[model samples]
Target: MLYRGSCHCGKVAFEFKARLTGVVRCNCSICSRKGALLCAVPHESLTVLAWADDLSTYTFGNHAIAHRFCRTCGIHPFAEDVREGSERSAYINLNCVEGIDISVLSIFDFDGRSA
Candidate 1:
């Protein structure tokens, strides 16, 4: 199913077409601190509705992934271009998705958040 999610201020909106197959919690510094649950989707299946200029990008460590968020609401909705070999993958934030019964979704723990 496709899910529509937006920032708190509505300045940023996006849709991703995919099943809520599972969620991955990365132990990486930022993700661990932010408590973001990564929702997987085909990169091309995502649509950004508005405010590219209002979106801010953050990168660290290897600088491979560009984590995008709404500068107005400070919500990290998803991330793009995480791995160079598989640029077709983008991770969305399940926390921002509505109408989803997250308790039913399988959750995977990634080692990134640990150290």
Candidate 2:
């Protein structure tokens, strides 16, 4: 299914195809603090619709994942990284999705803090 996502200020926008199941709740510092529920989509499945240049990136630890956020609202709408399988994908923040009943989604807890 195609879903629309954006930052709080709407400065950044994107469209992606995801089933919205198996969203991950990670214990990593950044993710835990932000309370982000993420879902992965292959790079080809996501498209930035606007304000690509207005996004800022943050990386730490291995510095392999690019945590992309909107410069205006500082909302991290998505992140990009190559998984252990050596394939690139975007980890979409479900909080930024335009319209969806988040309460009904099945979430999986990931032990990222220990990674």
lDDT of 1: 0.83
Q: Residues 7-88, candidate 1, lDDT per residue (tens digit)?
A: 7787888888997778998989989887899887778888988765888999998887788889887998888886655556
lDDT of 2: 0.89
The residue-level lDDT of candidate 1 at 89 comes to 76
Put down candidate 2 lDDT per residue, 1-115, tens digits, no spaces: 9999899988889999978766899999999988899999998899988765789899999998989999888999999984566478999999999888888988899999899
TM-score of 1: 0.89
Instruction: Quantify all predictions' global Cα lDDT against the true fold.
Output: 0.83, 0.89
Clashing pairs in 2: none
TM-score for every candidate vs. truth?
0.89, 0.92
How large is the C-alpha RMSD of every model relative to the true structure?
2.0, 2.0
How many angstroms is residue 73 displaced in model 2 relative to the true structure, after the best TM-score fit?
Answer: 0.7
